[model samples]
Target: MRNKIITVCTAAVMLVMTASCGADKNMKKGEKFLAIGEYYEAAIQFKKAYGKTPPKERDKRGQRAAKLARCYDRMNSHQKAIAAYRNVIRYKQDTPETHAALARLLLKNGNYKEAAREFQTVLDTLKGNRLAENGLESALTAQRKKEEGSRYIVRKMDVFNSRRADFSPMFYGDEYDRLYFTSTRNEAEGDELSGITGTKNGDIFYSEKDDKGKWGKPQTIESGLNTEFDEGACCFTPDQREMYLTQCTSDPAYPRYATIVTSNRTDAAWSKATKLDITRDTLSSYAHPAISPDGEWLYFTSDMPGGKGGLDIWRVRITGAGLGGVENLGEPVNTAGDEMFPTFRPNGDLYFSSNGHPGMGGLDIFIASPDKKTGKFVLEHPGYPLNSQGDDFGMTFEGPHNRGFFSSNRGDGRGWDHIYSFEKPEIIQTVKGWVYEMEGYELPAAQVYMVGNDGTNLKLSVKGDGSFTQVVNPGTDYIMLATCKGFLNHKEEISIRQTDESEEHVLQFPLASIRVPVLIDNIFYDFDKYTLKPESATALDELVKLLEENPNVTIELSAHCDYRGSEAYNKKLSQKRAETVVEYLIAHGIAKDRLTPVGYGKEKPKTIRKKLTEAYPWLKEGDVLTEDFIKQLDKDKQEMCNQLNRRTEFIVLRTTYGMFDEKGNLKNPPKPAKEENKHDEDEIFDIFIE
Candidate 1:
């Protein structure tokens, strides 16, 4: 009986020893895989070792769990990482680093409250740890952001997504009907799996919209662009002539580094991609390229030195040669945590993904729009549905529309980024303006300076068609000044009222010609009489405002006759009309000596203008409306020509009106003040610190 009991004890002891040895072997294998950056394999090995570790050996089990959590974190298995980290905490292995890592994972998993607690714990232990402080701030903000939903409607595009990761979508071609993205599906071009991701190497896959505007099956770009090495995030020049792509070349013995490469467009496929020499800094990783609206700069993400964060958005001047002068975006745009995947809208708004900024969770998308007043970029977040507790990034717009596609990992616990379409049903409150000469065609060379009560100071560049459209906020007042080289300046002030729906207001700027007579339309008088009509009050008021706007200019206010009445009667009536205008002007604050009333009665005939020729195809420009010419015209044409001849016009007599003193000698005029929009020193300091 004694021998039997001893034998059982010996057998149990041997079994225990065997399990311990296996766990140790598994741990060593996991450490080896981790050293080589094979996170997926390392995770599997670590999980096995953790399962084999005995519950009685809490220290050993805790260490194994910690390793497993780290591996899962690297692999982006957020849910799994959270579970493993909880196990580490349960086993009393709660180091400051472990708490920080656990907090980050919880934050990524949408457990904002838990993340905040853990982040606070980390901050308490590791005093002044910027990463922990930032995480805490993010966690607290995530709770509020999650509660406040956004206007953006987001939905997964399953047809364009795969079981594995798919992300970084770009709209291509003229119609933006073609979509190109990176994927790790089974059908990816490469057979070899990434050491870092444990999935097939990323390849650039694309889909084209059919005649019905429906997306077709995604196809891999199987040219030299896709190799066994990972290739992803890509952008094109505005002209779409050249493509910039992110490439990660792996070495079995060392860690992989991401670098940007350029490919020239060919007739069929992209030419072989060549590495871009953005400085000789091979040690830093550069990825996620975006071209500015004017193609003057190349914006990308990098982990180089002098950045305000772990990964910062950097830009380099794009010259005829290679890139010149690399600069960090700095401060508010870059944070202690990672900021990656930069994209742009046609209006020069920069969109990017960040973990450092206060957000809903994970890598939330943010916009950095330039403040026209301060010349600084202001950050904004599109809350809720557009952003989630999962990694959301890689946004692409269809031209200037707000509706577009982005990548998110929301419902996928595996953290595999999938393409999701997002659209903010536009509440487009805008101001569309036309700046032109008073009686001539549009002035395309004009420039408009705008100032809004909401601290908006924008220098608007007019389109070739002499039009400008700008989005505006509700209940704001905007003042705009239109200026052209050969025309007098015109100013308009508008008040945008708050409304329940979108509205577009139109403003017309008719700058008076400095070299020619500007006919004032809408001025009315009694039939064959000199008495001013009540409707003429509005038109005369407008002229009064114009005169006040250009205070230094003195004008010749003239009235003409229609050549129907006798020359003496027409001259006498025209003289009375001119004097009436001068009297109204003097009553409205005009200096008496500044006005020179002229009566041109049937002597100077009117010539057809471009606008008139367009309105009446029978009439051509340079055609004069003389008495004989009017006699040959039809009844309607004769009346129109007669109306054109009986008009009131103003031409600048002198621009230096008030520059002369009573002595007739020229007095020095106060230098025209230069108006510029600049931020005060305190505002700049706040921006830098922020």
Candidate 2:
């Protein structure tokens, strides 16, 4: 009986050893697979091993759970991964690794607040975990930003709902009280799946608001323009007679390409769509169409070869033939990230969506100001509430209304995407006007100077066509001045009242021609000396006004000598006089940088005795010229000859403001100031005759 018992014990021990070896082998294989990124297979092996483990091996169960969580995370089953990570935390209290993993998962799921708390807990439990500490700080910061964003009052509009997906919304409202948008709802007439995402196709839909401000049910727009592939993103001309939209093509020969199409509305029904010839095969894709307020320009997004990255906003002039060649919007607006869905408000401000820049998540809407000079767009992200860690895009403004619609996937009870109407806070009134010559010509490129009530000077450059626009707060009076070289500077008061017109105020400035030399209105000299005296302060002030008025105008200061002094001494004195005027101007605010002083001495006299004699027979004179004789000369000749001796004058050399309008009409002509006859002969010798 003893021998038989020993045999049974030996067999039992052998069986136990065999089972243990098999379990060890399986565990090793699972770990190897996990290290090689075979998470699905590894999880299976780990599950099997755990099932075979003895009940007393509780640590093995926890290990298996942790491994399974990693596998889920690798497989992108974030919810399941999070649950597994929570189980690891339950079994291993205060463990830094487990807390870190859980916190990261929470953050990925957009649960920033919870993630922040978890990270804080880990930091409190352990020290010297720099990575965790940094992560905690980031999570807390994101939580604060998210909270702030949620405070804005957003009006929800369930404009479209699809069993599959509805996205990329574009809004257009009309005087007739109707709103239009793009959707991929089930009721849309198109193919089942999108060629790009292999999802539901997209179409255009519109809704109307009643007199009570309640939105009506949305319905698909039926038109030959919308194709079976994809058609969405519509913008209307200011007149609302024409509409611009994007049409996608799915053929592999034309993968990811979209063409801009236009249709006219007549009798409340849209005409057949016509494809614009602007699209080219070399362009990978083109989408998101927008038309300028005047309908002179068409803007869209494309992934052409020269784009900054995945997609970039481009614009082209709309002409009779078709859209001109596309031009890329570079830098600040177009980043390495995808930029799409461009819209233009009636105010001429640009709005678009981009993922190329840092934001909460996905794509966020951004605003850009078209820099007419550089032909570039300056982009600015609407931070916080206007943006979120979710895709917020497709924004449009209703005419003159501060309230508008935008699409967002933000957590506002809508599953993934929804349309929301938001009221933009009160914006300050802006003053925009054009400076032109009195000849009814528009000066497209001129420099504008705005003097605030506090005397602060703001300078702005006009467009190439001499048009100037500026933004100013209401309740402030501004001194608007436009200036250019060889033209009279313009000054006017622009009073912005609470009731100022929202449309651009058209102010046509008529500048007189600066054919004659303008007197240094405030310049003063010592009794008989050419030196600039302290009293020149007044003249310096006037010069400063001129300079501030014409920020881009450059002048040449010329000093002349009277017949009283010897030629050499007069030359020296005149040179000194020119330098003195330059110094005064520089002291008063005129950039010394722009003044070039020269002395004509006795050369190039304003009035020649022979010319004066011929013009006016009364000037039958000798070497000494009479005041009346000088005055009788031509204005240019009289002004030139008057200073044949001692005087200073200015001639415009360069200008920031252009002289002509689009039609080549002179702009900003100088007005002649009234003249006085006081010093008689001395005055004539000082200013006119020598």
Best-fitting candidate, measured by TM-score? 1
C-alpha local distance difference test of each model: 0.86, 0.65
Worst 10 residues of 1 by lDDT: 681-690
TM-score (C-alpha, index-matched) for candidate 1: 0.63
Write the residue-wise lDDT of candidate 2 on 520-607 in tens digits.
4345577556767787777566566666666667788888665555778778777878898888788777777688998777664443
Where does candidate 1 stray beyond 4 Å?
1-21, 427-690
Q: Which 10 consecutive positions of candidate 2 have the poorest summed lDDT? A: 681-690
> Candidate 2: how large is its RMSD?
21.0
Quote each prediction's TM-score: 0.63, 0.47
Candidate 1, 46-137: lDDT as tens digits: 99988888899999999999999998998898878888888899999869989988888888887889999999999888899888887888
What's the lDDT for residue 313 in model 2? 90
